[model samples]
Target: MNTKFEELEIKLETKQAISDLGLIDLTPIQALAIPKMIDGLDFIAEAQTGTGKTFAFAIPIIEKIKLVKETQSLVLCPTRELAIQVYNEFLKLVKYQKDILVAPIVGGESYERQFTALKKKPHIIIGTPGRIIDHLNRGTIDFSKLTQLTFDEADEMLKMGFKEDLEAILQNAPKERQTTLFSATIPQEIKRIAKEYQNNSSIIKAESETLTATKIIQNYYVVKKEDKMKLLERLLDISNMDSNIIFANTKREVDEITEFLREKKFNANSLHGDMKQKERSYVTSNFRNKQLNILVATDVAARGLDIKNVGLVINYDYPQEDEIYVHRIGRTGRAGSEGLAYTLLTPRTEHKIKQLEKFTKTTINKLEIPSEKIITKALENKLIISLKKEVVANTNTYDKIINEFEQEGISKDALLNALLDKLVPSKKVYEVIEEPKQKKSNLSDFDNKKKDRKDSNRKPSKLKDNAVLVKVNLGRKDKITPLIILDMFGSIYNIRNNNIGDIKHYQTYTVVELSSKGHSFINNKTFKYKGKNIKIEEV
Candidate 1:
């Protein structure tokens, strides 16, 4: 336990709640941000996953909250799952202060239920920006009494294109209110928002080493993009773990991976934003209960989830940003437990491995796929364990079947061999992926230095086999966001929202991942959105 926590002079109620949770020491971010936030100064904190940023804000907010429950604090998150997570964290922190009720209002959930919750007069309401905007428009929410306003994952909210909604909410907020923002990265947009909406704010960050997932054992194997599934199959076949998460870059890929794994007899499910609330709940519950061994998800959909005991994390698709790479691997190695993470890199993405290493400040060792001998040995060991279980007084159940086989002149040895043939899969060669015989001078740099010029609106360049980075000529300057782009495509071309991969926004324009599904249709032409013709070019 750190003596600094005692110095904060936290209330007994919140302290007891913390003790009950077995939280003896404060994380660095919590230690710094908690004290400042509790002091009622506007604040900005740069925090990463697994860094205890939620508790940093929750602790201070809970301590200063009024007991009467008139909406003293409001937290806005980027996704329904994250909003719910913050709500639950608040509940835990205020366990002793029963008067401090908390509620979650997010999209994809029934508004009537939230309205009923609001009527109870929760002391704090955590919600997504859109739903909160809806409530504000309806005059159902009362921020007149709100003293503390927070934006968790502020960077993500901007990425999802909630700048206008956030701004509108800020415009309606009390100027004297204490404002706070926490994000994994402090982009220029975040800085601009702080300047516009917050008073002079103190910035806080932990030591650089504390921000990355250094505890997890990390490795990667370079493979042709087409051979990724073969590597995944080999990993699953040889792994001794109970549950794992396979992260993809897009929802379409999530479903594809899930479907492929299911066909291979692996218990897997897909989790993404497109799934209904109930469907997501069902998938998450089964995963937590160990009914599902593998979960394939995209970054946005996997946010704020706290599933435990995950033994391995697979980056099936290379993440688009450094923060995303850290977040994906941070799913494991939680709670001081040992965990392993693997990345499958293609020639186009192999460069990202170096960037990942630089960002995490750790070595990512090269991992070779299991050799045939190792695979066979693992399979034999698995079979032996099963045979051991069956040999222990289960013969009575097989008596009838054995007699039938004997009458058919099928010996026990032959029957067992046939069973083995069905249970064990045939071996195939996984092509060895060798690094380029020639390396570039900047091969070790992780920061993406070569960027398409904003003015370089030339024709689309040749992309990797199935993915294209298309630049759209509308960005934050034009009040553009990913949702607007998605909506335009959905309405105009009958395109599914998930067909595109990660949507990266710039000041004057945006870059979108046109995967095979999208590449087949996007004509590199112009389309009008909001009365302006938006042109797209290949980058």
Candidate 2:
């Protein structure tokens, strides 16, 4: 879909590697960074995690790695998990070249094995800051012949308090080598490193100049911390999610949530950094294959492991940092797919939500907790859709079968009722907190209708002038009078009491209008009319 990659003088092997990995195209980050990297330029790339920045550098790094080599490249990552993941990614991308080897040296592994691996004289070294520096000091790893040095998740490394170690690692590397820094943010420390280490470098900013997970509808559910588990259960039952991951702030919470879900008849597994290698692999594989519908994880454990087709990500507890929240939500809505990220927030977390909104540049819509009635309505909607799709779509065949039943003397009402019963499954009501509705105070009943008639008689004056009529499913029965509508948006949407164009209310639905603008505003949201759930959309 993008033609920019074609303009660059890229190696056939590199292009083939991308295609072999089924990455036929480039993400915005890749498109910007790859051309610069191919030019052998030192660069700093600012991006979020899960934005394909990994491959942006890996593709060029692979292209430059000589088949016959001696540790020509060194990649420093924040965590051992990320280091291992980068190494594996390099392995997958460079499948065309059999001579290249990526050795990941990190903690929690026997130093003897890493020492022996270093002895093999690998072409590339991928490691965390502390372990990489340990090897550098012991002379177990060689970087004297290194041509390129990259710091993956530079911001993360600094956040993890690895600045001094990162500096030491960089100091040991050759000054003549090219350096590439990749981070979700460009902080002062990152700039300091770039200034000291890099030459006339290019700056690739993917975050400010790219579309990211546009399909995802992000929302947060504000709940009391004590009621989070009960709310999570209700959410699971209400949302028709096929698969999901629940992230907790601690390993204890991960295990606790996993146990709670399992007890509640959900197939859930917990993964934390404390797990053994085999256990981690088993949990991840089971989750990926849908053998488990839920995975409870800590951020540290789920780092850098790619899982596909996740429909939802629940932030059971909010992350301490805004960057961590970005990474947590990034787990879902990956590879250009729609996902839902629901954060369970307490009253104290209002500031955190504000910060998140500012940092992510996306509004987190607040959703009312699912009540028994709301869940029932949602289920009915699903049933109606399924019946229309599965039963109505096959009406001809069903008609023939029903005719055969009629020959056996089955009554029409009996048959119809039976079909309806079969199509609509029974659901149990659940407990949920109720939100109070605000009542309108100013406009009188007669004045409301008169105001609507006055606006309706007025002429259109705005751009693309056209009068569009929209309807909302709320009425007098739901306590949504014309006065209520006028009061709700009085000054917030620049709507005035006299701007209301019409007023019509049936037992179940209401039709209202405004001078072009107010109609569009109300039609775009899901809101409450009195205590009832009201959905508004274009006709």
Candidate 3:
């Protein structure tokens, strides 16, 4: 059992602030770790995400921090987003503690602003490892008086290749200070950090009975890597998601998915660690405000985001760890509302679902990719329902206009056909997309696509016959194979590896033959390789 916030040995202001946030009882990690950390003992905590580990460490930092402000506490995080989020939480909890100042030091923000904030001698420094290390080297930060130290998400920091920076930062900090390292999982490197850096510390695990939310209908699709995007678009169109999140593993993937969705006329944007704070704030605000309906993001949005009312989550790429999977899906199905999570898996990664299922202690139901016809029928049903709602509205003016059209020999059936044609799309969005079994998009897709089109000296081959042949700038000189060209087509256009017939590569361009069925895959629409516009024209 955990004690109430009022019972904790803390200042009246701190207690009042915690109470104001509607937090009555302490979380398991807080009850276990706070008392130990407040006692000035080095501690190692293994806790799951969203288990109140923030408050666990924050409460102790507030209780033990002195009024004399010269950087008394330092908390290092893996990413700028987490650092900013933690800083915001402290800002709220310390609302009544007027004199105790805190500052966030993260990359992608102005150094002059950080220099100004550091000159104020803030009592708490919440920052990413890289920025903190830079400030330390610039002599702008004085951790000599650091009385308390914490490595929040220690596992992530190490995974981000920040071990050297961590060692350097730890070395510069006062050895006599109280230290605590908190992580969702305890890997060997995290254990090594605890052993090498801290005094004798005790381990505390805050495991939950269930790893994920029961309200989330978790499902995995064993789709090929090339077909993931096609299936993603189909699901979004038919599922009717509101403010949904699409998670990808890399920043490049984030950009690619967001770009692809936008090209297909979905209201979507990308979020990742590489974005500036203002850029991130804008994207999140738009998402939270419902101005943007779909958010294509990296795992940076998973850890500490406060956005609510997510209707669905789609993992464009599966994470290697169960913790990342939990956090990714945790963005949805919050506050008792039901949500759906769909994970796309390739043949090689199909077994990882078993691993995630074992770790989460829940069955991950297998999902089938809905065919194009089914998705179109579902969308048409929605259109019919929406149009039926108009039957109740007063239509005297429209009826008179229709009467005139009837007099002009246009049948009511003809009018209905016109409305249907105008209201619904003529073809499925995935018609031009190639669903494939193997091959993936390159990291430099956007740049390479544009460069190959714009800067190349090659010209389009003249049509010798009505045969379907498309000429592209990438050829032998670009170090591309026939399979590579087919994969590129598979990634964007709706064709398969078998659909591509003969491939003749020259120094400047490659001419590819498409079977008669795949000829319709060529389009003049602004197709996006990765947010940039490209086109495939018929020869």
Candidate 4:
């Protein structure tokens, strides 16, 4: 087998593209599939996600397409997210080749834009089945010139109920076109499609002992639903992950998690089905460029995304299906590189952990939540390291400042402590404790708060001279408890709990007290809680 891409006898331009991508050697799937693809043979490949399968087929398709202004290849994916990902990969491979145009045609995007792109006569089209069928029906796409067709994630397409769409596409394509199908599993549906469309096709499978690669270390933490967010924050703080993807089950969860992380000042963003095409593109591009540190996305939004150096993957919500669990964790640990995956589970979902471990045929070790002491120590260590770097980088400035402080009768220790306090403010550290059981006082406390608010004519608590009252359009109706609001304001705006004076919850609105600085930060800024935008205004 050829180790380097140049050994595959590809054009110099294609080889240069590979080198530009900084890929020195081919992955196992790529090493196996690229040679046969380059030989112009139809085949079915079975490989897990994150095995560099996109390049396996893309390199050959790029090599075979003529420079003529006509569509010569079609790559069909299950979702728009996957389609765009494939198109982006094609763009990278054809970066130096100016004549080749690759267009993504997917649903939920402007048809006018896709039609305009078709007018340019792209050499390759990557899209979903439904959108491709739309173009085919409208006479907007010409498959007569097509020479190669690929079905990426074939099993997923079938699962997404695209079997009819796939049939329509295959039947309409020219019989002379070379067909290739790639899937994680060789189910009967995939085999049936292969038997029907592929001719004399080779079957290549990258065999692995487990569903998940051995390079990925799997772990799980059990916590209550209410404490999930706190646990996540602690895990991120202790682990100090560089690049990570957090997967949720629904778009709502994605939005909520993204909002929470952003409030906490983490470089985070969200991607899901509800977002427009342009918005999705922006998020994906930023993530690929490392401008975003954390991406909160649903499974559909992350399908076929192949960003490298994903140090960790957090399954904030346990997946419903076994395959989803496999795919979610597969985002990390690519190309034989080591990675870590953590799943947050509640007591109700604890049994599912065992089922997942059994299904993956791998061990998932239980991880203990970091203690408050551990987190505080980690923060201290980080602060010391950053201070050391600053001191090394500006020794003369620090010396001058120290001498000035000395002349002012200030001790060096006192000067440093003052500087440290300004740099890192003390906040309440989370304790490594279990969720408290429900108590009658909880309800009584809520009732007393409500009574007090009503007695005070729904006015916020007496504020300091500079304090301001701000109203948020979330209340008891939307499960907006006082604790939730407090956490948000404290984390997002860096307002200490003590600084948050009074919170009065109404039917559809809530008023809270904030210091002048906190009020300024919230004055013109919009906040999102649980996917709904909340307009904060002075009352």
Candidate 5:
């Protein structure tokens, strides 16, 4: 445990909560941020994933919080998954403290239940921008009593385009309230936001190692785009992988690839924004427990999720930014354990591959896709390892069987060959051959979360105008089915089923009907398919 934690543990109820969570020491970020946090000075902390930044901010916030029925602390996360993670962490730190409520108000949850919880008057509320905005507009939460605000992953929140909502929420809170922000990098926008709202804030960047995932054997595959899935299947078939994760850029791709893997008999599942909080948690837990072998996910859905024993990470779709690239690889190779990261690249995306190399500063050596011959060899190697293990273990259990075989006039070589034949797979090397494809899908779309469209000049629709023409940069060739697109939007944004009118899957882009709650709700943080960075606008 870091000495810093020992210093603060003596002062608050959070100490017991930390002990319960089995966290005895402060992480590097926690060590530095906690001291400034306890001093009540506004601060911005720059730290990466797995650095315990949540606890760094949460411990101080909970310590300062005067436990009561009324709301006193507010934490805004960029995504529902992240919001829940932060909320749960805070709950652990404040578990033994009586009358302290840590309620999560985020997109994709039941409004009535949240309303009921609010009536009981939570001591703290942690939520995403859209849901918090929803509660603010509905007057479901009383921010007048709010004394502390923390924006976890502030850069990511900005990337999701929550600047307006964040500004509005801070404006509503008391100026004297403590403000804290944590992010992986100190981008210009982060600096700007701090300057605008924070009063004489202290800036602290954790000097700990920035490279978080060193145990992973990072490599890339230079395959034609169409052959990526075939390669994925072949790799899983032969490698001794305990579990795997595939990262995609869009929610639609997550659903499509998950179904494809399932059809091929892989125990696969997908996680993204469209899923309810319960479903997301269930899938994540299953993946972590090894019940699910393959996890297909979007970057947003997988944020702050700590899943151990993930032996491999496949970049089904390359990330747009360097930070995302780092975070994805960081998921594997954790806790001093070795891991493998496979990147499938197409001819067109070769440039992005080089960019990633420069960003990570680690040479991703090119390797051939594992052929049936290579896969068979890998299986043979595994069988050899098992054979060696059997020979070295306590031998009394197997000695009787060997003696019986000896007495039956079985020669040693014949007996050993017979046993090996029974144990190893019968498929010959040639029979296991899988033909590589000429090309594969790119599995990426124009940044939907960053795209934004302007409000149309057309008059508000009448009863028959149920069709809302929202656009996305996915089409037929990209393997985007209607159900997949719907699931994507539903998971990533809070778009309801009935709100969608008609969906026209164009060759290059898709257009769909607007849901019942038109402009006001659609324009909020619930929908990220807008902005100058991405080209999304209403017709």
Candidate 6:
């Protein structure tokens, strides 16, 4: 039997909010934690990411909050991204209550803005430990009126060396407050925190054995690192996915991948720490409103975000942490809906797959990279489906055109083929390359060579006849170093260190010699870094 949110004894407003968010059924974590939290009991929940953990606590906080002129609930997260994400989720839950106010306190933004928000006497406070502690030290925030507190991603916080900050906040907070700690994994530090702070806390464990929802179809493809983007593009072309989030390891990779996707005519954006708050919000809003179909983001930038209807999650680069792998794939297969997660792996990272399987307690099946023929067939099938829909909607209109063509001495079969050709243009699909049998080493040698090149004052005129002088629109003024430019080009074009040529830097632009082939590959393509389009042209 399935449990619904309505069955819980929450306020009608909260119930309405849940319905507004289109949440009909309660997830396992929510089902187990909401009641205990509403009863004002302390809790220590072991729930994985994307398990609707935010709502497990947010709904109860909204139901029990008194809407006083002071902070009644305080939620602490590990990073500013997660803090803002939690604040946004709380806002959704309190949409029906006009009197309720929430504020997010995190580092990286102006302190004056936080001070102004604190002066408003928000009913709830959401922030990271460091920023929250900063507010406490300045005597700008008071927790005397706090009735409930939550440590979201508690294990991550401790791992980030926030034990003293957490202890300071807990010491100042009222002991009678309802405390809750939620973590994906309960390390010894988390256990210690729970033992010391929580009073008779109801320990609820949503184990990793069921961490990944059964609805998610997980698969991985083994390919060379250089061929990752090519494989990714092929998958995107053939998968018929409506919405996707591609995870990369660094901000540079996120920007480069997003730029590549946009060049391919994909409605894509990037989210990373380097982006300002406004830009991040804009990208997120566009994604939510369907203005953007793909969002390339780093793990930290995407934490605690709950975007709806994400049909696919692609790990373009394997994550360093096993837990992060879970969170990356967890973005899909949400809200009882079916989703697909694909990971691109190389021989060097193939062993991580087994570790991931053990950590997630779910089998990640091996999948062969799709061939050009397979992709072409998939594209044809999609076009046929679309043509069928069009005919079903306006059969009479198409029938008239078909009759005219038939009367003009055109056979029905020929007319149909022409229409199909027009609907789905014929294009050359790249074939999947087989992985080499040789053992591949890490990129330390490439990194060392890049570092050496960056430190050298090389001139562009010394390049070979095959090299072309290319100008890029970013320079030292924009904090664009030589290595950054190299990384951008290398990531987008999958070029090696030797393929690059001489380089020169300027105040507002840089000129570099690229192999004629490399120059042609990106000749008319749009490339972006830090959300700014890089205008490239051969000099």
Off by over 4 Å in 4: 108-110, 209-216, 240-244, 255-269, 282-294, 306-311, 333-338, 347-363, 385-397, 429-539
Candidate 2 similarity to native, TM-score:
0.69
Error of 6 at 322 (Å): 3.1
What's the lDDT for all of these models? 0.81, 0.75, 0.79, 0.82, 0.74, 0.82
Q: After superposing candidate 1, which stretches have Cα over 4 Å from the reference? A: 1-7, 378-448, 451-530, 533-539
lDDT of 3 at 31: 84
Q: Candidate 5 on 229-273: residue-level lDDT in tens? A: 777787677765778889998889899888878978889999987
- Each prediction's TM-score versus the true structure: 0.77, 0.69, 0.70, 0.71, 0.73, 0.72
Residue 459 lDDT in candidate 1: 23
How does model 4 fare in lDDT? 0.82
lDDT of each residue in 229-339, candidate 4, tens digit only: 888888777767778899998899999998888877789999997898789889989999999989999887788676887889999988856778888888788766898
Task: For model 6, give the RMSD to the true fold.
Answer: 14.6
For residues 160-252, write the lDDT of model 2, one tens digit per residue.
567679889888888889899998878766887888889986678875424336666788887766688888888887776778889997788
**Model 1 compared with the native: what TM-score?**
0.77
Give the lowest summed-lDDT range of ten residues in model 5. 448-457
**Tens digit of per-residue lDDT, candidate 6, span 490-539:** 87777665667777665456777887656746564677766898777665
Give all candidate RMSDs, comma-separated: 9.3, 18.7, 16.6, 18.0, 10.6, 14.6
Off by over 4 Å in 5: 1-4, 9-13, 16-25, 95-99, 274-282, 347-358, 361-363, 387-422, 426-539
Superior candidate under TM-score, 1 versus 2: 1
| Local accuracy of candidate 3 as per-residue lDDT tens digits, 128-153 | 89899898889998887899999899
